[model samples]
Target: MLAHRLACTDPPVNLLSRVQALMVDFFWDRMHWVPQSVLFLPKEEGGHGLVHLAGRGAAFRLRFVQRFLTGPADLVWRPVARALLEHCGGLGLAESLFLMDLKGLRLNNLSSFYGGLFNVWGLHRKERPECCGSLFWLLREPVVRVSRFVCGVGPSLQQRLCEERILTLGQVVEVCVGPVWTTLQAWPHV
Candidate 1:
């Protein structure tokens, strides 16, 4: 039930912390020696298997992101989620999410739902840096024009690329090179 609520809402941090402390206290039932985090580990790992509310909340947020990305095309929440993402920087949902740096966004100005979702997503990406090398993932990275690699490239170029439907490095390469670039040998990492 609490998981369901977390999926739909972002509870206040103080409230979550308070509830966590209460749960830990009840579990301990007296003076405790182990750190609270150890309690969240599996019993086989030499600690009680207790739920960590904040980690659970973050898991719920990641689940929401997974659904948002791969859910049925007709999902009722898709449009609302897309609109929320679009509001962040007026960019398309994919661009705002994958191309632009998540830290650069004004996350505080958005609803907690998206703010938390993006935060978790960013952390996930950072934790698994290998994901950045996958062909599908690399394709979503920004081109040199929009990326920090180039100097003095203004928004006009980005706008032009958007107008030309070339928002990513993959698109730019496809346009400049040829469709033959899709061969597996072309990208060793892939």
Candidate 2:
């Protein structure tokens, strides 16, 4: 029941810890002789197969992200998800997920739920070395991701850059300063 609930919603950390303690206490006669980590290991590995709630929660969120990204475009939750993404990154969900400088994300009004989702997605992406360094990923990476002063670049600048279709580092290098200046006439420099 708890596992199923975790798939849909994240429980508070303290609550999860309490639940884990209770489970551990129930498993042991009186005292915990083994480390919690060992208990979380597989039974085949000489430890009881304990379900790590945090890891399970992350897996569930990652699964949801997978479905959101690859599922049919008409999914019911897409609009809500897209709105949240746009609010944070000023772009579509897919575009923001792939192109936004997530490291420098501002969570002023955003919920931590989505923040955790992004962290899980980032970790998942990093796990796949081929995807992290792939041509497609590189081409989709926002210029700010590689910027030295990433936090210094405000959302307005990032949005302006996106509006001008200067999304990636490759695009920034290829674009002519004249065109950018043409659109941003008030700006002294391109």
Q: Name the best candidate (by lDDT).
A: 1
**What clash pairs does model 2 have?**
none
**Per-residue alpha-carbon lDDT of candidate 1 for residues 104-123, written as tens digits (9 for 90 to 100):** 44566578787888777767
What tens digits encode model 2's per-residue C-alpha lDDT throughout 116-177? 77777767534334445454445455665444327565877866876876766546645744
Best by TM-score: 1
Q: Poorest 10 consecutive residues of model 2 by lDDT? A: 125-134
Worst 10 residues of 1 by lDDT: 142-151
lDDT (CA) for every model shown? 0.70, 0.67
Those runs of model 1 whose alpha carbons end farther than 4 Å from true positions after fitting are 33-38, 43-47, 71-74, 126-140, 144-166, 170-190
Reference-based TM-score of each model: 0.65, 0.62
